[model samples]
Target chain A: MIEALFAAVLGGLLLLGLHRKVIARVQQRPGPPVWQEVLHTLKFSFKSTWVPETASPGLFVGIVLVAIGIWTAALAVVLAGGSILIIFGVYMLHKIVEHGFGLSSGSPYGKFGAVRSVISAASEIPLFVSVAAIAVFTGSLAISDIVAYQAVNGPLLIIAPPAAFAMYLVILSKMPFSPFAIVEGKELVSGYKTEHFGVWRAGLEVANAIKTSVLLGLFLLLFLGPLSPFAFVVAIVILLVSLSFVCAVTPMLAPFDSVTIQALVTVVMLGYLVLLGVIP
Target chain B: MSSLGGAPWYILEFGDELVYFTPYTTTLLILALVFTVLALVSRPERQVEALFGTDAIYAKDTTVDQMRFRRFMAIACGCASMGAVVTGDLFNFTLFVALVGITNVGIVAAVKNRHVQNAAFQYGLVALTATVPLFAGAGIVAATTGTLSIVALASGTVPQAPFFARALLCLGVVGEGMAPFYAAKAEMFRAPGAPYVIMCSLSSLLIFLRVAEVVMVI
Candidate 1:
């Protein structure tokens, strides 16, 4: 289990590197190597780090630990085929983590980033809606049950396309440069992360790497069912490339615009849920 | 009983009102514990604001007196959210949820800033208005199903709670949390006490997540 987790961290970092590369190439810029993010984490870890004078020392440091801890728990949940509702819960808590990261730092930019994170809470609502839509079809919230159901009844991607679409948007909203990631917008100078540097930033990088792996793996598991290890890797790459294309082509929306779009998506997903006759 | 979702793994009974731990509730319970501990140990940060037309940066300090009230409210909010996560009675869940809403207001009400108090007052109004639906929804569930115990409601022994009752319960939570419209909550977070202010968001989120399960189960 530990080895698998380490591999997930490594693989997830590579995927993030590839995500940057894909975006760069699409924009006609020569991109850094696919191992850039892995090296970036290593480099940040070796730098000197300390608590800022204006910061709440306990929370400034504690929030980083919490950030990594929750995502680690999330990765464990996905690995164990636990309840999908737990994943939805983790995804929502992540918004708080972002808020924590920004607010604990005491930087105006970080607070603004934190506020944007709060505003972006609407993005994850569709994830809950998607989970409910899936449970409506499978009659269970357990990941193992959903996978088993898909095995017998084909991929839910075909069976319930709207749920798949909703989950996809939820994942997209988390991607580094996607239009919905206003918390990490450039205008805020790395947004919530503006204040976290050195070892703290490295810890966040590790968490983001694991988050990337877990969300993508979850998407495949939910929509495509189980696959061989090699097939799973291939599917993730294809999905990452698709997301990168969308990221490269579209400029990030203004914060409110981004939230508005995500909320609209939630309304539409809720409409889809109503059509499916589920009141969730 | 060891199922990943809603199986009751541990139960503490108060006659018919029980505090139960399903794997789902356990996850939320742990989150509440984690944040509660953080609130206890963590000091509020001084917010740094750059001068409008100068290079000077000013840091706003949090007074010990200020921390006392917010910390107490934050811990109270945490306890309330934790109760909402584990309670087995539908009415208790609604009650716990409402308590969280009240504590959320208190978490920021200690701040002297007009902006923060303004936000808290508006949020308090929304939370107070939301209680009618929360209690009414729980009341309707008991009236129709003739039981307010979630264990009984989930056992298929009684009729399902009407769709409106469940929807109203969820609506009440949404209002208490103000999740879909977090603008008011956002303004409260600008008040400069991370640990305490977080309780406001965390409590509402916990109740929101718990209500999702409650509405589905009951």
Candidate 2:
């Protein structure tokens, strides 16, 4: 479990670096080294962390701890092959973390970001739909059971391609430069993250990296099933490259537009689910 | 048997029926307790100053009353959420759900802003209307199965309910402010105090979770 946590944190940072490089290449500009995120984290960790006078000190600290805790729990669940329902629950609870992160600071930008976060929660419905589709196909909600089912019946992607695609979009929203990055868009001056700095910002960055790894790992587990260590790394890299490509090409959507697109995707996924007989 | 590791711990007896503690309820109870403690210790965000002008005149005694009421509502909301989770009787569960609704409204009712009050009123209307289905579902189950005991239902002593009753029960809980109805409730969170406002969301979530279990079991 600890190894999985370490791998997720480190691999996630590397993936972020790769994503930045890919975006830079797409824009025809020089980019930082692939180790840039690692250096950024190290620098932030070494700096002095302070509470903003305008913020509630307790909630400011608590939100960061909650973010780290949730991501840690999420990685542990994936590594331990626990129930997927727990993962979905954790995903939903993340809304609270975002809300707390913004509200605790009492900044207008942070509050706007928090409101966007609430609006963006509509995206999670599609994830629940995807999970339900998988549950229907596997006859269980446990990650291990789903993996075992895939071993016998082959990858669920063949059976539920649209659900997989919908999940891909959901995962895409979590990555930087995606249309759904409204919460931390340039206009909001980094949105909910505007108030956090130094060590606290470092913690948020690390937690975010772990979250990225977990989402990709979960996608792999659900769609591709468990693979050998070599195959797993290859699959993760391939998915990251695809995500980077999407991030490079797509302009960020307006907040309402992002919600509309997700809602449409969810509607289409629900139609696919109906066709697959996952939903009646 | 006194207790089993994964089995429900029988806490009370009413003739052939039993009230018991299961892992599901225990987990929610612990969560409610933790949130309750946080509410007690956390400071208010003093949102009134932000929403209204500093020159805005407000009576000091009324502000004090609002704070006191908000605290009471927060604690009540937590207790109601805990009750909704821990109670083993289906009828009692419905009662706790109703209490949660009232207290959720209470939590934000003290906010001085007209928007907050109006939102609370809208939520209160929905919550009030939702009770018909909540109690009606319970009544239907009792009528069909001859028992309102969750243990009896889970143990298969009672007959499974028709689809309508289950659907109604789910609708009632969801109407208490899940996704579709969340718009009405979201405005309530705009009220200043974070600790107390959080209780509104927490109670709704806890009750919704408990209802899923209750619907599945009964």
Where is model 2 more than 4 Å wrong at Cα?
Answer: A271-280, B1-33, B46-65, B82-93, B139-161, B206-218
Model 2 misses residue A148 by how many Å?
Answer: 1.0
Encode model 2's per-residue lDDT on A52-75: one tens digit a residue: 655656677877887888789878
- Model 2, residue A270: C-alpha shift (Å): 4.0
| Residue-wise C-alpha lDDT for candidate 1, range A33-93, written one tens digit per residue | 9999999999999999998988888888988998888888888888888888788888889
Q: What is the interface RMSD of each candidate, in Å?
A: 1.9, 5.0
Candidate 1 deviant stretches above 4 angstroms: B1-4
* Model 1, span B117-215: residue lDDT tens: 998899999999999999999999989999999888888799989999998899999989997788888899899989889888888888888888887
Spell out the clash pairs found in candidate 2: none
Writing each residue's lDDT as its tens digit, candidate 2 over B1-218 gives 11111246447676654556654456557657766776776666533223465556321122657777888889999998888877888888888898998998889888878997998899899899999998899899889989887777767766777667877887788767454335666677677666677677777767766675566456
lDDT of 1: 0.89
| Residue A198 C-alpha lDDT in model 1 | 99
Model 1: reference contacts kept, as a fraction? 0.63
Worst 10 residues of 1 chain B by lDDT: B1-10
